[model samples]
Target: MLSVRAYVPADEARWDAVVAQSRNGTFLHRRAYMDYHSHRYVDASLMVEDDGEPVAVLPANREGDSVASHAGLTYGGLVASRGLRAEATLEAFERIGEHYRGEGIRRFVYKPVPHVFHAAAAEEDLYALHRLGASLVRRDLSSVLSPRERPAMNTMRRRAIARARAAGVAMRVGTDMAPFHALLASVLERHGAVPTHSTAELTLLRSHFPGQIVLHEAHRGDELLAGVVVYDFGHTVHTQYLAASAAGRACGALSLLLAELVGGVYAQRPHFSFGISTEDEGRVLNPGLVAQKESFGARAVVHDRYEWVL
Candidate 1:
């Protein structure tokens, strides 16, 4: 029999272990990452067991009458061990439904781990959601590059990188996040927005997963021109945040940094994600932003949202 229960503080180690061993889980799903901004949500994460052995975990949180896959994450979903199969996944979902219904939650929001992030094919929960009559509510388009079969970098991107190199733009993998965060804040300020995480939060996160969370920067004659923070998931590396200064844009510092990442540093990785180019729950696509990503030989992959009334 399959069973589900609310995750407690005592379950931290076990929860992290399951994520480390799961086919679809990344370091992002670990409690260490999830709890960094705990004050923002009421965690409703679940642990699933089969005959008393932990089999799966769902990273989620409660919001009024509904429960959603944790909002702080890029993608949250069922992270299952290698041994889990389709039938058991369905049972797990059924048990999850029962547990939440008992808690007075009237709706469930889900976002399955994107296929590129999976260490193996782990879409049993998607099938389970379909069986449960879930509605496909949103789809955000992200650009991803497959290193092994990627297209050549477009001419415009190449020229930009060349310009940066000619301007003596240097790429550094470093620990000082403040400079980059400052540049990021300035870029977002023009759009009347802000970064999702503060420098302190990022520093804390880096402390938790030192090797997985990395900062790469572009500099020219002591000036911090551009930077990107990447979350490395072994098989894949995702650009969690990227920003460029005005000088950086003029000299193509951002392009240079990305080129080094996709072609020099992380070229051996299976995938490199440039993140989403859509907004307003996926209704709007930022054409210029996506075009820039595509210039680096990246193509479309989707992050989806699904909902079902309980």
Candidate 2:
């Protein structure tokens, strides 16, 4: 028999274990990462079981009559154990809907794990969502590069990297985040926006998962020129945040920083994601933002959102 239940403190070990063995799970799904901003959301996460053995976990939160797979993380959905088959996954989704309905939730907002983050083929949830008549409400496109079959970086970008090198830009992995966060804030200010995570929150998260979350900085002598906050998810390394100063942009400091990461640091990783370029729930595309990423030989990988009415 299969069943679903709300997650609790005692379920932490089981939840972490399920994520650790899940084909599409990243460290972001772990409780430690998900609960960092627990105060901001009413936690309604779920765990599904087959004969009392944990099979899947949904990192989610409840707001009003809707339960979102996650509002805190980039992407999430039914994170299934490696051995879970299509049939079992469908059943898991059924139980999840039933459980939420019992709690008076009228809708489910699901943001599925993008394919680029998968360790192996894991599209069971996508199939399950379709069967349940979930509508694709949103689609954000991310740029991804695969080491095994990467295309050549555009000549303009190549020249930019050369320019950065000639400017004596230096790249290094750093533990301090304050300097980088400051630069990131300044860059985002130009667009009338701010970072998703507060500096203090990012600092705490880095402390919680030091090796997995890293800050790559580019400097010119004593000046911080550019930086990219990276989230290392085993086979994939994602740029969670990125920014550059005016001088950095002129000198292509960010370009050189990416070259160092793509060519030297994480060359063996299966995927390197440049996050998203869409805004307003995917209705708007930032052409310039995406073009810059594509110049580095990255291609489209979509992050999708679905809505299911119970």
Candidate 3:
């Protein structure tokens, strides 16, 4: 028998345990990450059990009349154990629909983890979503590099790195977010935009996930010229934020820093991600941004969302 229950504070250990075992889970799906934004969303996350043993966890929240698989986070879905069978998964989703329907919830918005993050073979949820008649709602194009393939860096990137080296720019890895955040804020402000995370918020996340969150900066001696905030998610090292100062751009400091990350820092990783180059549910693509990422041997990977009536 399968049962779905609402998540409680006491479920923290069990919840994290399931996430740790799930083939598709990342640090972003854990309670430590999701609850950091507890003030903003009405949490409705669920834990599914089979015969009193935990089988999966759904990190989600209630927004108005619909339940979203975590609106605050980048992606969320059913974090099912590696051993969980497909039929069982599909059935558990049916139970989930009933559970929410009983609560008067009419809709479900799901964001599945992309295959690139899977520890083993995953994607039973994709099949279940299809079975449930889930509709595609949003998609964002991310630039990803398969380092295992040892993709060739474009000539333009090689020239840029040569310039950065000649300019004496160096890459440094540290826990410090202060300088990088300032550079990020400055760059974003010029575009009349803002970073999704504040300095304090990012610092808090880093504190909670010290091993997973890292800051890499391109510096010329004491001056910080360019930087990228990387999230280490097992198979993938994701560039969550990247920015460069005018001087950094002119001297190609970012180019050098990225080359360092790709060739040395995260060389062993199967994939490297340059976060989405689209806005408004992928309706708008930023040509300049896409071109810049593509120049580094990165190609498109879609982050998608689905919806279903409960």
Which sequence of candidate numbers ranks them by lDDT, best first? 1, 2, 3
Residue lDDT tens for model 2, 1-310: 6899999989999999999998999999999999889999999999898888998899999999999999888987989899899998888888898989999999999999998899889999999999999999999988999865656899999999999999999998887899999999998898999998999999999998999999999999989999999999999999999999999999999999998999889988889999999999899999999999999999899999999999
For model 3, the stretches where C-alpha displacement exceeds 4 angstroms are: none
Candidate 2: which pairs clash?
Answer: none
Worst 10 residues of 3 by lDDT: 170-179
Highest lDDT scorer: 1
The 10-residue segment of model 1 with minimum total lDDT is 145-154
Candidate 1 vs candidate 3: the lDDT winner is 1
Q: Which is better, 2 or 3, measured by lDDT?
A: 2
What is the TM-score of each predicted model, taking all chains together? 0.98, 0.98, 0.98
The worst-scoring run of ten residues by lDDT in candidate 2 lies at 143-152
Candidate 3 C-alpha error for residue 269, in Å: 0.9
For all candidates, what are the clash counts?
A: 0, 0, 0
Two-way TM-score contest, 1 vs 2, winner: 1
Candidate 1: tens digits of C-alpha lDDT, residues 9-79: 99999998899999999999999999999999999999999887789999999999999996778889999
lDDT of 3 by residue, 235-279 (tens): 889999999999999999999999999888888899999988998
Q: What is the lDDT of every predicted structure here?
A: 0.93, 0.92, 0.91
